[model samples]
Target: MDHVPGGFALNPRFHRIAAVEVTEDDLGRAIPEHVIAQLDAHLGLLGTSTGYASGGWTAADFARMYQVVYAVLRDTGRRPGEVTSLHRDCLERVDGKPTLIYDNHKRRRHGRRLPVSESTAQLVETWQKELDALPAVPGCAQWLFPSPGQRNRPRRGHLNAAQFCNRIFRDWIDELIPDLVDEQLDENGAPLAYDRTQVVPYGFRHAYAQRHADAGTRPDVLRELMDHRSLDVTMGYYKVSLSRKQEAVRTVAALAVDRHGAARGFDDPLAYEVESVGVPYGGCTEPSNVKAGGGHCRIRFQCAGCDFYRPDPSYLPALEQQIADLRADKEAALAMEAADWVVRNLDDQIRAYSKSADEMRRKLDVLPAEERAAVESASRELRKARSAAAFVPLQALTARSPE
Candidate 1:
């Protein structure tokens, strides 16, 4: 109370350190790939005769631990607590595919069915068999990861997530510290040492979100997989790294098309961003318009009819939607007996957008299957990035007013 500004107020007179805010640049607590690999390698040996047996850790304990960690990583980054407390009958078949019937303890959501990879399902089945083979430990029949037998205590509970995190997982990470190094090179051209703090158990969940984000998973689809109720919460789990964004831009550049649907190629994909200005659903390449910040359009922003407008397959959905909206508007105008000029303008835009969409589709249909898949993947990433950034207002970010 003595440190309070007026001896009674909540505010203190001492220097107040503000909390660090999260930004787009923040990658959250996702573990580095190398460290994850080390963990996986060590965990893979569990259930085998050569698994870790020191520090009072038994083969059955190793098997249980492996299933808990491995399943979380493989199943879209489930919470460790959820995985640890999973009921013994968690595995079920849904729609002819192996599905995990687990509870979302954090969200109070129960019986959430998540489809697991074939290999993961097999692992779960194999663990069930192994558990059956073990000598019946009293009070452990109902828990998938029941607490191992203790000398004087009742072994009637599941593995404690907090205990595992504080001791078992911590020790495992420490053991692999010497081998964990960043993929990026430092100023000396040597592999930088990885931070061990980043490989915490919960970091696996962030890693799962990032793995999908890097692979160009749509935000809505990722949100569903994460069981998040809002895109904002789902997006918080991952950020597209700078390197991944640049790679996507280069890949999508190869598929750019002009207003006429003719394939556009850039000799230097890196220069494409510098030489153009982004407009609605596409980019403008006219030098003057680009320099004037895309405001000096000679044709009054008729981007569909503009010669410099370049769009790729990434904008196909938007283009198609715009065309449909224009058609609907045209019908409404005709019913309302609107002006001839307004009707004509809408007709022109619909025709232009439709032509562009058809031409892009034609170009895409002719590409080899492998190239087409790669192009589609790259375009999805670009679209995902655009959708993620579209909602943030520039003025809201740049405004200097405290309010």
Candidate 2:
């Protein structure tokens, strides 16, 4: 077996176990006690291992990994890759609300708010507490799960690598529910029954969706909560069983029938008495002999044709002047605010860079004259390039252009 990067060995024939296909059956089978113990020990060593000096797995990494895989399994009836758009930061709490933020392969962040189940919330809370207790490693502050051997730089966090950690969790689930691997074949030669007794890591998410349906959550709400771009996708993926769909249909049908029975005729006197009065049609004008004249009649509802119509040309100049003044004030305020914010942020960045540069210079000062001179020359060129750049002022950049 080839030595995997994080204290584990993989079959030599397989280039990477991380990319290997893991079926429910593969994960559902019983894992011996020794293997479980080994896995736990490995996870325990992740934070303290000096071998992972570059950066190693941290508690946050495990939490994030658990959430992503769980969401995929829950949101889609199937596992990962079956669902095309899984959020990367699938378990973030924003403004006291659970949100799922996805990053594209290019590392751009986009996200959606997720409606969390009580169980999922509890699990997340437990994980958050555990993560808060772990000490932050220097230089790995940005990483949710730091890897080993990364002392001075952030590690490239792997989504698939995190998912692979579910192997141990899956094993534990199988131990609790031994019948998970058992299957019954149907007439179509496909499995009619698949074991789903104990909750695996992925099962947490499945349970989430199921609970929502059981709670009689609306389909549109479910679609939004699950962060599905299309309602059809949500229906196809998360709407697992026919029984749930039938229940939803029945509920909607009952509501429709009730609405139909309760509806009143348009001419009902009681309805008119109860409802708020709307604008009277034609506004107190007789229905007959309506002509364009001194009467309530004009050319297509014009003042000449209708008594209610009145021209207001006198307010035009005043309105325009008011709008112009308001626009000028708005522009000035926006410009000032933008300029202030930019200056503050820029000052912060400048201070940080200056501190880094001073530290570098101090380190070089200890070196011989030739090395120090070379470093100083490089620094001077960098400063010149930065100063000469065509960066526009922040206010000018954000200012609206004249139409």
Candidate 3:
């Protein structure tokens, strides 16, 4: 078949088209945390005489080449063809940092330099030593990852790097694709499980994109890192998982939950009756309709420290409960390894809550003794109820370490 030059330039102006959009199969098939831990262990065993699984492929023997390939894919997000074309001394330090020069095989370009993470640079350095130790392929001295000593084509490098790397990936697919469905002669001779993950070599690249997206990397930056031709390709893998979406909804709802509201501001020296649905941080003197007409306040829930806010002594219990709820939310966010921005926001809100708590305490101190006592008693009762509601087993608790 004759090669078509500048294929992208050829466009059909005459015929209408319905291009088939390819759905992403591995939507959320990121390398699981457990699997990542396993990979780390596998990486550690490399260069050492340790038997890894039953593949008869140990680190000391056939591991170096595969390890280098895997590390490049993991760290650089380079394609298989690009990996095969790499040469020794590919490292180019710029601004006191290591960068890798990768050849863009798909684009038919030469020497595309990309800044690399420190850990990946280290991996490349380690792989360099192993590459040096291997016997040089007569005609392929420049190829960094030369094909392992072949019987006939000894001089030629990995003729098909994509296929070779794929075989290595498949060999380790058991650990990589633990949830991969298997063909079996079951009762129906078919499967019912959802093949959510793509059990292919490309999963590594997919995983790279997915991880960056989850870490909240911008599309443009991610595109540069992944070496994608279009932002749409990078974004295609930036799918929001159901759990993440649900967490987002819960976070927003938690901000807007029903809370005790004080009917009147504390500045009004005369005592006023506390309405059933009064907000505790009462600063809005605007008529309800007028307040509604203005767009919602960005810091609506931050009533405690608001300049126009007044904390009613009557709703001290509810105010304290907000603090407790914030503590719980902070714990939940940390447990989930929620985004850095989210964790920081929760921490900032906690600081804001502290200010609000101080404000409430100051107002209560000036209140009549009887009124102050009543608020204190309500707070104590609420604390006890909350404690009882969130009971943990004694067996789960261990004594704190002595300082």
Candidate 4:
């Protein structure tokens, strides 16, 4: 930010921070990739393990307690409190997929159940049976995660979330992950070399967001799934590891392929020759019509929404973003009692972009679907030809012609 008085910048005193204020990556406690991988590795080994000591039911219960809680938080993105207080019958199907319906302590929307992966649901089922057979909590015996002492009336009645977070994570999880056992950082995001404790259970939720982000889940959609009140909150943990970035790029590239071959007009929808003047939101058609640096525009609400400019539907992600932004604007207008003209304008722009999206699905008539397969096959062969390494005398190839 510029050091100027009353400047429009990310100075929190006057305004909110930038789109990404601070991400998990910026923090020191961002769980390392190996940590999550280790958790996964442990869970995998746990699945086929029947080496429970014959009379050591206590040890088996302890294992179930650890795994089930870990799995629930991993899959459902529930807080530790929600996970601990979860009932045995909290399992159910939502939209044909297994879901966990529990009180959302942070929000009032318990009706919006968190969808659980099939593996998680299976673990929950197994734990449920084990829990039912053993004993219930003193007051609520049906608690999925009840204390062993509940039946014997000793100590606390249910699984202590604080204990799980503070002690068990350090004791069990740390020993399980030797590489990270001694990793810690001070307040300055610097490593605390002398410290031997690093991993925490809360990072699992951040890990979940990172996983979805790595999978290329859109920010808005992820925010809804994470049940965050703001996109800023969701983005705090959405920045993922470098490997996930590579994976996301590959996934997007795969989407650009048609049945025949590489998607025709995959980069641009306008297929016509036009000098693109890159703008903040999109490209400008009438660059000559504006001034330099921060150019001028007759209607500059949005570059994509401009009449003089053409938007690319092949840019599916950006098109989707525009649609989402327009919807948000429309909602805001309605809520703020803005004039009908403003709402109508937003609606019209949304519909227009939506039409562009439809056209993109048609691939801008690049090659007719029936003719595309042959063209694509030939195109692939041609690409292979062009990509083939041309042979030259090895000496000549290696020799420098001039200094």
Candidate 5:
């Protein structure tokens, strides 16, 4: 066939695009607390030994157990290819820190060093001893994750990332589903059935990034830890889950107020959901305003003076700044001999924002120190979530025209 005309044509594999179906929702979401609990419980049941080829458990199971747990603890968001391809002696003590020496094959970057926790280093040590003791299979001695399959391609014998995810990992999850409980609840208030689709091997990396983001890791630090070439990719993995957002919303709601700076009660969070239309620094409660995406404001965007305005402590800084700006504009209008209406408008805005700012500060000052700190933290999270790139307008993200 090699001698035939066009027999040396380019390999079809190079020409074909691989179409991998994404079977999960939000692949970047952290594994649920309950699911993580279930994983721990199940691993406890399986016992540590990688049983013989004749029965109970295999090396693959043990390798996966270590891999998943290590991935979680390390929180480095490494790819499965990187983990599965680790050499037998992948750990080193560099500058008194346990560092992992692995290859980022996908990026064509080899021998990358990552500082990891001592506990994770110990876990790797345990796996190394366990792998050494396990019954040897053909062509499997060199890899951290030796493939448990019978077919041996001696040159490339480690667990394939795709097979590890689609088969080895999926199979283990199947056995765990009956014992798994989801963080969500059904209409009957019962714990919902576990969604297996949510717990893929790759999602651990996403979870790692999220865990750090929630713990207030700086963006540049996170980007370095994630080993991404750019900050944009790192930001993609940083998401504040809906539950976190709701919690922040509830916290900020405690200090919510109307335009008059009077305290507003949102006893039921569900009812607060009705006032969903967001304004610059707060929310609009009027039905018309909410339905019109805050565009049809009854007070024409004069949020500080509108009865429907529901500003919380999160808006305090912006409100104070607005007051200062309005005052400056008023002075400028007075100096320019501007129309009475323009000067009066600026004066009214300054007064309204000043009243709101004073009320917000007064309420904040009276709270217990710990509660005040919590409110401040929640306000920060809420503000950050509001301005997250996911909500940015599409056109705003595009490059500006040369003109």
Candidate 6:
């Protein structure tokens, strides 16, 4: 089959079941008014139920299925190999709430508990309710949802597999949101359609990340919540910065302020003028780091040379105290940047040591009896280099005289 944009084979079965081939108009068309109404009702029920319904799924059965899969992904973020390890103990009831306990693969421990976010927790609550409401299939646990089988027995355990859920998601998208489907060509010029639902996954994670970003959550907090090991991974791999979103909010807020002032005919022309000037750049009016003998500081708010600079003299003593509070933030940011760089460099050194060790082992395997001593000496030198590098940071710290 030709690969679809999102990534599943276009299930021929959906075309038969849905009994309709979506045309280009259908693909590009807005969701029908009836569908919108149905969605509203579904959302209302889902909000009351807990959070189990799939965000995009229109049918109750499909929504329940997607909810279950989403819960699994939100809990583990694992490939198939780790799914079986997700048991009841892997979850917890904290403060009278049910929560997942994420195993830290890097730490190799279950004690590293990662609580489900509020949104995800809400979803799980609704899903659990929905799942409970479903009629139990014969030969299955009370919690099991009905499957498409003769006796409605629980679907095969493999149904929980990442690949399987991915496939199902693709098929569901192809059947319900046909416009999302696309075609690809094979080497023989044969056309095939694949499902790409997995590519975007209905933008749930995007929406989740966006909510925190919009609320001005710190990047570090976002990284931790997103389970990203690095801030760069969270910022670069996930999405754009929160600043852009804040800018959007600022734009709307500015207009609202203007509208309110205009309605009362209490216009502050100076305020408009200030707004027109916008934020200043570089060190034009503020105290420049240049005067401090430090290289030109790029700290936006701290730069005395910046045109947008407002001095402490302009503010009351109480306000000046508030401004002084920002010094801690500046120091913290600088420290975080320094620590991140140190960690990255240490990681690189560790990787290099591992590579060198592997090479030395290979050389030792092939060394002749006479050359064995020389090979062993080279290995010892490599180990010494690695050990010395480990102590370099500590040595540098001790070498520093009183500040």
TM-score of each: 0.60, 0.32, 0.50, 0.49, 0.54, 0.37
User: Tens digit of lDDT per residue, candidate 5, span 1-403?
Assistant: 6576553466564457754423332344667555776776665433133343422236555555445544534355687778878877888997788988889886689999888888788888887787677666557667776655543223247767776676656766776335677767899999878777778777777777766665545566776787766455555545567887788778877678887877885765555667656677577788887887777876667888777888888777678767777888888999999999999999888888888888888989999999998888777676556545324434225452333
What would the per-residue lDDT of candidate 2 be over residues 1-403, giving only the tens digit for each residue? Answer: 4454533444354444533322431322332223333334433332221122223455445445344344344443333332223422356665666544443322232543445555555554565465456655464444333333335755443334333334434543444333332245677777543444334444434444444543434555655554544344334323223343333322212111011122122232232223212111111122332232223332432112233311111112222333354456556656777667655544443343233334333445676897555544333332222222312234223432232
- Candidate 2 segments whose C-alpha is farther than 4 A from its true place: 1-109, 117-126, 138-140, 145-166, 174-206, 237-403
Give all candidates' CA lDDT scores.
0.71, 0.37, 0.54, 0.56, 0.69, 0.38
Clashing pairs in 4: 136-141, 137-141
Model 6, 1-403: lDDT tens digits are 3455433435453334532322311111222223333333433232122222322222556455544554455333433323323432454668966566544443355545556766656655566566556654443332222333223233432234433344544444444343332345677786544333333332334444444543434456665665544344334322333453233323222221111112111133333223332121111222344343234447533322233332111112222333344444445656777677655544443343233333334434665766655433332332222222222222224332232
Which pairs of residues clash in candidate 5, taking residues 3 or more apart in a chain or in different chains?
none
Q: How many backbone clashes does candidate 3 have?
A: 6
Name the regions of candidate 1 deviating beyond 4 angstroms. Answer: 1-27, 44-64, 176-178, 237-381, 390-403
Clashes of 1: 0
Instruction: Write down the TM-score for model 2.
Output: 0.32
CA deviation > 4 Å runs, candidate 5: 1-28, 44-75, 135-138, 151-156, 238-250, 253-380, 383-403
Worst 10 residues of 4 by lDDT: 382-391
Sliding window of 10 residues with minimal summed lDDT for model 2:
252-261
Q: Report the C-alpha lDDT of model 4 over 1-403, residue by residue, as the tens digit.
A: 3575444435453355535433432334545565666566665333123333222246566666767788787776666877887876888986779988777665666645777789889889988877667644455465777653433345345577886776555555545443332246678877554233545666666667666654445566677777776555655454334454333322222223221223323243222223443343333456664334226666764544555444332244556778898999999999999999999989988887676565555653565676544433332322222112111223223332232
Q: How many pairs of residues collide in each model?
A: 0, 22, 6, 2, 0, 20
**Candidate 4 runs further than 4 Å off:** 1-28, 43-57, 107-112, 135-140, 149-156, 180-196, 237-403
Deviation in angstroms for 250 in model 5?
5.4
- Of 1 and 6, the candidate ahead on lDDT is 1
* Candidate whose lDDT is highest: 1
What's the candidate order when arranged by decreasing lDDT?
1, 5, 4, 3, 6, 2
Candidate 4 structure, TM-score to reference: 0.49
Ranking by TM-score: 1, 5, 3, 4, 6, 2
CA shift at 98, candidate 4, in angstroms?
1.4
Superposition TM-score, candidate 6 onto the true structure: 0.37
Expressed as tens digits, the lDDT of each residue in 29-90 for candidate 1 is 77756677766667744344424443344775665755455555545478778787778898
Residue 46 local lDDT, model 1: 34
